[model samples]
Target: MALRRITQETFDAAVRENVDEFEMDPDEALREAVEQFQSQGVDLSCIVKAVPAATSDDKHQEQTHEILQALESLSVAQDSPDSTKAAADIKCFTEQCLLGFAQRYLAAQKGAYPVILSYCQKSMGEREATFAALSALSALTDGQPDLLDADGKRFLLDALEQHQDDSSVTRAAISAVRHACLKHEQNRQDLVKAGALPLLTSAVKRHSGCAEVVKEASAALRIMTFDDDVRVTFGHAHEHAKMIVLQHNGLKVLIDSAKAHNDNITVLSELCATLSRLAVRNEFCQDICDLGGLKLMMTLLAGSYESAELVRQVLSAIRAVAGNDDVKDAVVKAGGVQLIVIAMNRHMIISAVCEQGCACLSVLALRKPNNCKVIMEEGGALAAVQAMKSHPGVVNVQKQACMLLRNLVSHQPNYSQPILEMGVEALILQALRAHRDCGDAAKAALRDLGCQVELRELWTGKRGGITN
Candidate 1:
């Protein structure tokens, strides 16, 4: 075959045609064009000059310069005779520029966060400017609280307090604070020390109509609970983070937000996960049950079969609420055991779902003897046994499975024959052999089934009283 000599114009034309006609992404089109030329034995190295890609620091500097120019123009525009028109123009321009910086968090990392936060602090009195600045701050400071100094933190808290009536500003402020404290312990502590809990909770109530505000406020409260000090203070030693939120009627807002945005998977997932975390504390279990948390969790579980993450969250929440006697009864009455089994069977491949499912069942079984009956009637014991067999690699699931089985056999001796018939003893013995960490529980479970001889033989010559 004769060689086809490809010129620069030809290559450019091919790229353009591929991008326009085939609707291919520009980068992909370029790559394909280059490959086509190379396959024809065309030398690309000599024709294609490679320009160095801009470093994150360099891009950040360029963005900073652009933002500074916009800010300067905005300052000058505010003083013009046509101040209203100029201010609007400046606000529009500044918002776009700030949004660009915020979207590229790497750009903010190179010392642009303080500059953006300064704009937020300075523009607090101007609604439009304040909204743009706060929005930018929210995006830029996410998980990077060190970007904001003490003054910036205080300003953010104040913004949440001072703009309670301004829905846009309040939402932005709450989101910004949420981002700031999401993973930063010091920032959470700072907010707590500054007494931000009441301000945030108040935002939830004051802006109940604004779903965005409620969502952001709930998110901020959720992130704040990650801090040990804040958790203890807000939840106390016995109470949960939800109790503090309940005091501010934040639970109603969260529930209402989930109801209103039922189709919004992200919103619902976050709300469910937050509720799960709060439900884990013993003090708030009944409160959550009284507030209809169990029904909500069951509903989520029923509808969330396609999303393992949502299923896991719902199961985890149920597990937490299962700690309460009334809640355990409520869960069984609400067909929660069936839902747990469904979650386990559907997402059995996912270790987290299995762990949470087994853990929830274990909690229910240990607390309520009647729950053992419901579990066996619902085939929950078989599900637990199956989970142990399927996820032998998941030590936590194995341990939880062992616990659930032990609960079933110990609490209701009448169910022992049924459980043993499920071949749970073999699964436990396998777990004992597979995961040494699971040996104690597994051995105990075998003993609970009146298999002391096997347990003795299994542990005869092994270190820690178990054979390998």
Candidate 2:
């Protein structure tokens, strides 16, 4: 027979029964409870398998955990006066347990998730308490995403839809939804199907002025674009990304949201990164340009010269949108190459900035000969060589720099000597030798730079090499 599941409260009560009624030793009581549960096929993986603490009034035992006490306090009926206090208690406990690496996980194991989720469902009529309960669920579900099952997903979506006018409630609930869908694929699909896309885009539109809401909603929107689910051979990442753009007017909403957050570097960085994710389509890339995305990104890049994180994201946005040929021309015409080189030079120590900067240059100089000249004129090639020199140990930086070099001279061979003068040939060779992944990119750069390279032939036109 399959073992039936029991709540932690039930198991804890059983253990307490053995200890108190039979006057058994605490260890013996716990052993008996474990044996009894396992004999009946109870899965103990989610169980804490420990004794409950005595009340604080009984000084003989240590005080129970604040988190546990809060959970217990929330399990009872909260009248008019007690509801506010209950909200405060859960909110405090959630904040207190937020920093621990595994406190929330243990809390969930102790039935904290259901308790908090139930409170959230019941307290929806009361905004403050609902926010607190939703906040608790968010904190608990952060690392333990599996706790967010179908019921939780449904509740979150309903809460988000119902609380559309309440930014705080929407923020807390969306924060929960973000944490739940983060690395869990089924949750992402279910939430999106349960109408997460429209709710999320609307949240961004409605709460554009609220930094916290916009930030969380931005993050949640980006999560919807993830293809992190490995079980499915073919992912819906591109489809979902396109949906967010076309079906939801995501580009205009995000662009408008970004404009309001120009002075806020963190929000700007997040929004910029999200825009890059949504730029999965050619026309979407064009739409980004149509929405003044390039102009906004260049403006942010120019002002954020000292902020490495923001500069890197801005470069990422620029790189993503430059997929369209016209956008590439616009980026170059906007002096994007000069700003990117300046950002790369300013933050050479940051491998991410260097990597993104090289990637941006590579994308801009892809097919446009004039853009390649602009890149060279603005020291784009030299910046790439310096990035390779600065972060040779980092394979991605090396790879992108190699790619940028390849693009620089792919169409305009005249720019090859100036690039070769930067001593990038040895650097390319070093990266090619040091990293297995950089082999193709580095060799292409070497070949295009008018250098001799060994090109391997996978198969010879011989009987032994013939599959037929």
Candidate 1: minimum summed lDDT over ten consecutive residues — where? 46-55
Q: For model 2, what is the C-alpha lDDT against the true structure?
A: 0.86
Clashing pairs in model 2?
A: 3-41
> RMSD in Å for candidate 1, one decimal?
10.1
Model 1 regions more than 4 Å off: 1-109, 228-246, 256-263, 280-283, 303-306, 433-439, 452-468
Q: Rate the local accuracy (lDDT) of all candidates.
A: 0.72, 0.86
In candidate 1, what are the lDDT values of residues 1-468, reduced to their tens digit?
Answer: 555565444666777677779998868888888887888787553232111122245644422233344444555554566646654644554454344433233334345555565566667787877777777667656645567778888888878777789999988888878777765667777777687888887876677666677667777777776754433334231232644555656566566666766666666777777666666556577777777677788888888778888788778778877777878888888998998898899988889999999999998888578889888888888888889888988899999999999888886777778788888877888888889899878877887888753444535565674678
Candidate 2 per-residue C-alpha lDDT over 106-152 given as tens digits, one digit per residue, 9 for 90 to 100: 67767877777777778777777778878888888986778987778
How does each model score on TM-score?
0.70, 0.85
Clashes of each: 0, 1
User: What is the alpha-carbon lDDT of model 1 when measured against the actual structure?
Assistant: 0.72
